[model samples]
Target: MLTNEYLKRVYEGLEKRNANEPEFLQAVREVLESIQPVVEKHPEYEKAGLIERMVEPERIITFRVPWVDDQGKVQVNRGYRVQFNSAIGPYKGGLRFHPSVNQGILKFLGFEQIFKNSLTTLPMGGGKGGSDFDPHGKSDMEVMRFCQSFMTELYRHIGQFVDCPAGDIGVGGREVGYMFGQYKRLTNSFQGGMLTGKGLTFGGSLARTEATGYGLCYFTAEALKCMRNDSFEGKTVVISGSGNVAIYACEKATQLGAKVVTMSDSNGYVYDPNGIDLAYVKDLKEVRRGRIKEYAETHKDATYVADCSKVWTVPCDIALPCATQNEINKESAEALVKGGCTVVCEGANMPSTPEAIEVYLSNGILYGPAKASNAGGVATSGLEMSQNSERLSWSFEEVDAKLKGIMEGIFHASYDASVAAGSEGNLMVGANCAGFLKVAAAMMAQGITY
Candidate 1:
């Protein structure tokens, strides 16, 4: 399917080297598919061997994270840090502390981070690190000990301008607080830029928590306006995942006059035709960490579907897959298209399969890729980094306003790039081409050793 002969050869080599890393391979293939126009435009890239270097990580660190639980037994977890590319800035990404953390997953995420961060026009490069240690159901003390052990090994490899990390799935304010504390304790110095998503009592930003979800809606609004001369106003939205991204996206969509009808966790999804309750959802997921199925118990009108992926089946004008990877498959995509979804925006990395994206694009749906739609989180993190460096904090309103502008910029960048590449309105291709141009230029300018 790769029509470019040069790209085909590069992808084959990349495939052979990273055959076991399906997620990474998938990420690379998606970018390659979009960059054919760029390759044809620039022979210097091929001469410089930039594509081959870009696919391969600059360095990868795998370490052992051993700690004791509340039961006084030793548990071991594998930790990974894939510094995929630093052509633009320091290796910057989140630390995901989940059971699914692996090299392939991190590489996929890190590779995506390169473009996501680049699209933000920020000075941060791409990197991702995490462990297979699930923080769920663990006592605070137990979690703290594991974070300390994880930081003990992670401290040496990261610094302010080196490779800064923030929070990701299974890692939040509490986890960040623990890890930041450990990093400080281990270094015996105040490293303000060491970790982001810190507690408010420390150097954390005000709008950091709501940035991603709010930004997703902002991007969606721009996409709607660009393609249909529309907005989130009066739209019906169905969003997957009850985590931070999903909840806040629901909140922002409702604020923009859209009715968010559904939200889900791993257990299942819940549909409330009357629109979701934000205060209740915030307490349930953010405070109590309760399952989304409990929404049905609390609200008599809502229905709880036991199948998580079936969240997409709920009828809506807009569909936001804010959940895990490959959440929206071909069947789910068909269901959304058949049900009359006009827009599909991703909040999670690689949340949609290739087939699902094809369905959205071929159906003339206004589709927003994850890199452009979900760049708000890292953009806010970058803002926090600037505030830290300046030893000052911006007001919540100031940060939120900046985030909105950046999201709008991202939308236009993708939309304009797609138009320029002869694939008018294909946001996936537009975003990939737009984000790649900046990083590719930086990499080429720095020479082949970069």
Candidate 2:
């Protein structure tokens, strides 16, 4: 039901051109659908063809990364950097090193980054880059060599005021350290601002590791408080993925008086009715790099489930899908609702499918889209960028406070935009519309740049 002709035409054109990229198309469609009300209000966006321009990337860099493995064998991996937009400022996003990294996935992430970064009220525009190189089970040297090879090509495309890349999924401090070291060596200059999520010895900001997870809870707490006059206190929470986002989200929620009952990995999920031990989970996932089933083995009170998606059936007051995209579908959403879940906040990009989102919205569940709820990581990255430029590293408390303020601001912005758009509590529409307005305005201001 796209009533606006311009929005409909743009979406149709996107479908025709990007029919093969379902992830990208889905991201585009979701935003376009949410912004219909905005389009109706602002006809000038249609005249300027803002949606069409915004949907297409500014540049896409794909190259080959060849490295020597521990066995002294040459291996080649495809690398990509999609500079989706820079109308507002330099391109800022994470470099994911998962095997699932592809043009479509990166495009979807980069497209979402444009709006996500916009929602942060930071100057960063959207862009995402990564390779099909999987870091799992790789030796330290092998990972280092691969990261060096990746940066040898990536260094040329990024700069402090150009594009700043951070960590995501398979990429972490080790990968960032390796890549930054290589980038510094190639350029023969120490441009700390060129990357965030660096090691503490470098120009990395404190609380950077916990920012996303902590930020998710902050945003979710705000959503609950504002919408339902509730908080995380005394609530049961379920978080997917035992990675940085999920683990820290669990920590923050527990600190805020909520008991997180479950955490999952790619292989499976662990349901601990007694609440997860953040220390033990961290040791297993971070240090040991072990599967989540280990938690069940260690804690007799916990039960291990083979299917990760089934984590939804365990039931909770709030659900945070910090795992990969589309991890939760319609059925999962139904289970969450049936389990008495009232709030759904995305810690990962597009974690819920369209059907899942519909279930949340139709069921009166408060839904916070990834762009707004998860922008904390990037917002803190923005803070890291500021610290880098200033040659000063703020303490963890300073950075965490700033992150909390930014998340609160984003929630209010999205809430207000949703209300103004006649969808008072639909955060999906609110976040999309609010994020789009800022970037669209910037794009319109910049005029056609062909």
Clashes of each: 0, 0
Pairs of colliding residues, candidate 1: none
Per-model CA lDDT versus the true structure: 0.92, 0.93
lDDT value for model 2: 0.93
Model 2's TM-score against the true structure: 0.99
Q: After superposing candidate 2 on the true structure, give the runs of residues whose Cα lies further than 4 Å from its correct spot.
A: none
Q: How much is 430 displaced in model 2, in angstroms? A: 0.8
| lDDT, candidate 2, 103-133, per-residue tens | 9999999999999999999899999999999
Q: Write the per-residue lDDT of candidate 1 for residues 1-450, one digit (tens) a residue.
A: 589988999999988988899988888999999989988999988888889899888999999999999889999999889998999999999999888888999999999999999999999999999999998788889999999999999999999999989998998998999889988988888777768888777899989999899999999998888789998889999999988899899999999999999999888999999999989999998888889999899999999989998888888999989988889999999999988898999999889999999899889888999999999999999999999999999999999999999999999999899988889989999999999999999998898782
TM-score per candidate, in order?
Answer: 0.99, 0.99
lDDT score, residue 393, model 2?
93
> Which 10-residue window in model 1 sums to the lowest lDDT?
191-200
